[model samples]
Target chain A: MAPAIKKYGITVSIGLLAFIILVAIFAGQVAPHDPENGKLDDRLFGPCAEYPLGTDQMGRCILSRIIFGARISLSVGIIVVSASVTVGTAIGLISGYFGGLIDEAIMRIVDSFLAFPSTLLALGIAGLFGAGFINMVIALIIVDWTPYARLIRATVIDLRGMEFIKASIGLGMGDLFVILRHVLPNTLSPLLVMATTGLGYVILAAAGLSFLGFGVQPPTPEWGFMLNDGKMFIRTAPYIMIFPGMMIMIVVLAFNYLGDSLRDLLDPRMKMVIR
Target chain B: MITDERPGENRPLVEVYSLKVVFPTDDGIVRAIDTMDLSIREGEKLGLIGESGCGKTVFGHAIMRLLEDTTKVTGNIVFRGKALYSLDRESMRRLRGKEIGMILQNPGASLNPVLTVGSQVSEVLVLHKGLKKRTAWDRVVGLLGRVRIPEPERRAGEYPHQFSGGMKERAVIAMGIASEPVMIIADEPTKGLDVTVKRKIVRLLKEVTVEKTMLIITHDLDVAEEVCDRIAVMYAGELVEIAPRGAMFERQLHPYVQGFFQSLPDRGLKPIPGMSPSLIHLPEGCRFHPRCNRATGRCRTEHPEMIDTGDGRCVRCFLYA
Candidate 1:
């Protein structure tokens, strides 16, 4: 038999990603009823001939809702990571490499962002914007970019004085090209690790927002919605909480494991450890 | 000593006079280079030999202007008659890779690990000469081949981490020579390499830079003994002796030069006594007198000015005076 993780790691992430893509492409088809559609008759139906994983209090198929929920979570993780990494990498390369006033100004702003408790800050932004899919994503994106920016900045600082950079400077490569072509690629391995590991952080954060009732609007069928709905009937049926909570644990672990393996493969430094 | 002014022959390419570089620290100032005169003629290979902290490496960095911002430099670094210290940042930048290429001490630390060898070398070509990328890349491969890197085209694609120490140094040489600059400054080019590889690299440097001037800085006397046409001996930030390599060996003057010659392993080995003086808190008067066996009242009380010895050489000691 294959390793539980072989069924789990990249294959799971790729499948999750594909499933998300499919949900986005044909969410109307795979999610049998309208995500908002609810019938009182279907409420809490056990895993019978029709409903697998049973139905939530809304009487919708839990399995169908879970599939659609994956779309929102995965898309938020990807989009937030992409935006944060892009903005962070650029800011970091400039601040670290140029490093005087530009460094000072950027670091000051980044420090202010980091000064707040991260969750409070995200919640504050989500509260200000009012809850919906786009606002939740926007809130996460704003909250997450600072760490990336700061890491990129530090890495750039260390690399700026190196001989290759000096050699590039000496040969007359302008400050721009040197930072772009030479300095930027060196920042990738660490940046990628941040993005993947940070994916888990973002996913968990989004779930938290949903649980607080400020994330996805109700009747939309998200894990946080499922978890919230399950909590009320939890004394009667705790299995409702298990499925969604396990979904969270499994995905977060998969991302973290894949992040570790990716770091091993892409970063030459880590490769030395295992060998 | 003779001066031939024939048109095709060499004139001095760079002259440094009473060059002094001191670094300011929280505790005190560190004197890296004392007032000293040095000159390099066109197409000549000069070697600077000394123990650590003797200011040989500091002097090389001074030439490249690669010192920390805290350091204070006072002296004239005249390159082909223009004062180097006075040049604006842009002019200095233009001069660095194109006019004066340097092969740094630690190829590993100096090289950016991310860039492949070819890309690193080609970077200089494109920057200095405004050569197109493809053209510069081709020249980089040619330079790798010149430095004796096997499968030059293939090696060019590999990062510095992929190459052995010797190969990395070769790539460094390739970077140094890419622009075919007038002067090449190599600081400890062969310090850590095995004996065989050291010999190969030394031979390669001499062979390729036949008509190109080079200032080679190393602690290894044997390599200097073989490769350098002229040699300078440094002690405690002072140039105690600068002479034609053979003459310095034949008629060794100054306590430090004698000590270096005595300390050479191949020449009946024994280590030189004592360490270099701290630049931050140097001894009063003569810096070398503390370690010199021949020290007397006059030697310890006053610094000696560099005295020309009529034989195309100079020494900074009272004995020479």
Candidate 2:
């Protein structure tokens, strides 16, 4: 790819992400109407001067709702990614640094977790816990953490064999010290790339759970919740579903694009290939 | 430099008796070190020289108790009157870096690339000396400067990749000597450097290890000649000869050692014929018999024990016996 095109791709992704975050942060100011408040007379109204993306079945402004939906999606993504990365990295460091029966045991446990389809696992957990934002977050975290654990464990296993690690052990530094100072820092760049990539998936999964009626309840301005609210009126007025669906697609694509660019920038090996 | 009180001139600081290190791989057990015996006298610089696969580095690792857990090592390594292999984990950790420093082969690979050169060196001081990070860092700067690294303060802050190969070696050497360990075990310290750099490192090694006991493992005979008071030649995991450096260079007793010296560029560069035998499937009797020019029926049929030739020399050969 031409450098100019690559640079433009990065810029466009960053711009879209920034726009979404800004919309989320200033939703009240940015939205022309209150996302939750609606008029009974204007229910299922087509796109017009007053309602750009038209009103939902509840007469809620689809544009306003989509604007506010970014808040829930982004926060859920951030919280789940940070929490899972911390848990998985710690477990991975311990498992890889102390290989043997412990490594075997932890890896087998991770393998079992990975054996299940992630979305189905999250669905099962969310179904069991009942519908709520916190429950959905918990479910997403449970499924998401496994991949980070696997990724980090692989990285740690590679790093553990590095001559510097043996040198540290030979230098009389404790295993904990070596893992935290030497091994953990070295694992960070790859972890950052994984976390960025995983963030996009986490956001997509959160929206997926909400669409299935297992996330944020009705009347709450979430893109997935809006899609589910607009489902029945699809044949009569597909605008309600189309706008929120487009929002989800655009935001997810933006996150993934940004993540790819970040990986290319942060990873030295990738940098060589690109240049 | 606070020198430890010297014991008797002949007292061994580190003694290895009948050491055998085997790695049980999928193929078979690789007999890396087989029935080895060696002693480093107090304040003595002993060089262990050998071919690439001759287990010289294994002996260094065995001394430091740095071998892998799966490696089956059966031996007695006594350092400062304590059995090294039998020592508890905590004590063994305490003994390493604080009392015994190990300079590993390949300085570029050995130094942690992520950390600043200074912090890597100072980490030893903080761990063993119980010094605060600030003081440890200051001492690191001093150590780097002593190793003759220019702009020591600035260089200490830079990561390993920013430094050149020779500079990395100096930084590693500084780390080794940072804790003022009683003994230092260096594995091929001068391995992959230019001639001038190798000479500087050798001189630096000699100067820094003046009063401390040292074990140098190298394939470079010149390094051994320049840095060691005594030289011990290893052949296929076994010691072939032990003598003072000057005397060993003057006259080699074992046929293998003779061939080794003759293979040098100035000594007509007559390469020793036949490969060194595989460690896992070592030849019977003398390990070097197949490669010996003077291999006799007795040399092929019976292994020769180390025969003390007096004058602080021992040779493993039927001819000496």
Candidate 3:
């Protein structure tokens, strides 16, 4: 019953996210045809009774393909973010807590990673490792974790001077205990907000990589890969690109809205405005 | 020079000799504490009184070694016959809570907001005494009762924000004494509480620190008079006077100490003239000469050393010399 959830737009956003997740979870049962099955006679068909949205150049059902693609987009988004946040938070805690040569070294490496545009960095990494699902995920993780590290480090730096942290240390708790107990919990709200928002960006980045042919290889029901296959026939069979593109947009928007609403809900300074 | 002597006690518990703390900042180098010397005997309560920014808290942090690493600290701090500064980080960590406890100035800021009051206190017990969680919980409840926190069982389950200011302070005190430290430093324990609550806090502190040594830092003379056995007056980063509580109130030697007592509402409400000196650019010689009515040419040119008077009294002034 947070005030942010009471807003009409955010409620709808939450519902949309839930619906998308459900569809992704039950993709096989929800779709009428196999996403990979194609008929030569029905190639490039538009808005038939059986093919509601239409068919692609290979006569594959676009609706079925887009529904199954949700699974890939959501899974990649979740896994990559989870791995990065774990690694990034640990690095940030150590760097900020110890705060001397260690801080300088870690921060300089983070800065170097940040210097390159994230997409360009991911592209280079993916290109080097050779293109595929796991390589693309690795590339995305490398490009994504710096923001988490930087944000958490900044928060931990401020919290290290707080009296509670000093009191904990004065009580004979070691550095590890203080950082884990006193420092990490304080950073959680901001980290959560960042993670929720970062999910949308990660999904978009994954799709972008796939669109450029470095993601899920051919015949996979990934939305970005579908968009890549349909681009050549855009003028002739626009529905092939349009339906999958719309699915990506809706999922990303759902995540962005959830992230924004969570920020308003979790930030104590925003309580008055929310109320 | 007269040497002030207490009747029988010898070998002080904590001895600080010529301690200096300096911080280099963007504005200038802040001389926070300058060549200060003090001693606290076992089972004695010493009150440190000074204006804000006059190095009282800094002196306490110096004893605890809690100041930032960037700060420049010089001179020795001997606690329980061990040199505190020369100890390794692990040894210092062990000594901090087990031997010397600290109740910070702001209770609200000193308790973690996200943690339950019980867990925070029990953390100390578990860490220092190796008490199991279940046993620590019962001890935490007992500690809460000792501090006179009402509904000790239920209150322990609540977070800091759920408690009132006075209750928060009591909780902080509970945490401070959890390890049964030999010396407890309570910094402005009753700073923002009401008068009634202040008296209660003082009484609670007095009861808990009966046989233990304590350093109570406060600008309020009444609070100090209520708890301290001996009082040390600090002015502009120096210990201007140290005397028994009764002796200080009956006869103050340093002019600044006299000015301090005079400004009290019970003592004519006369305000001390001139602002406290900025630490960055302190006066050339005796720091108090610029504001002293009894100042002479010699007083301005010479920094007076602490001259001991008989019967456990000392003052830094030319009049005593």
Question: Which candidate comes out best when scored by lDDT?
Answer: 3
Using DockQ as the measure, the top candidate is 3
lDDT string, candidate 1, A81-117, tens digits: 9999988888888889878788999999999999998
How should the candidates be ordered by TM-score, best one leading?
3, 2, 1
Judged by DockQ relative to the true structure, which candidate is superior, 2 or 3? Answer: 3
Q: Alpha carbon lDDT of residue B45, candidate 1? A: 88
RMSD values for the candidates in order, in angstroms, are 3.6, 3.0, 2.0
Could you say which candidate leads in TM-score?
3
Ordering by DockQ = 3, 2, 1
Residue A79 lDDT in candidate 3: 91
Once fitted onto the true fold, the runs of candidate 1 whose alpha carbons sit more than 4 angstroms away are A1-26, A98-112, A157-173, A236-242, A264-273, B1-9, B24-28
* Tens-digit lDDT string for candidate 1 (B1-321): 222224665788878877899987887877888887888888888999888888999898888776766678888888988898998877777788788888887777667887778888888888877899998888888889999999999999998889998999898888888888988988899978999999998898888788888999998887787889889888878788888888977878888788877877777676667877787778877788888998889988898877877666888888867
**Candidate 3 lDDT over residue span A99-212, tens digit each:** 989999999999999999999999999999998989999999999999999999999999998988988887778898999889999999999999999999999999999999
Q: Write the per-residue lDDT of candidate 2 for residues A1-275, one digit (tens) a residue.
A: 67886788889988988888998999989999989989878999999999998998778887888888899999999999999999999889888888888889988998998999999999999999999999999999998888788888888899888878888888898889999999999888888878877888888888889999999997888988888888888899989889888888887787787788888898899999987
Q: 2 or 3, which is superior by lDDT? A: 3
> Where does candidate 3 clash, by residue pair?
none
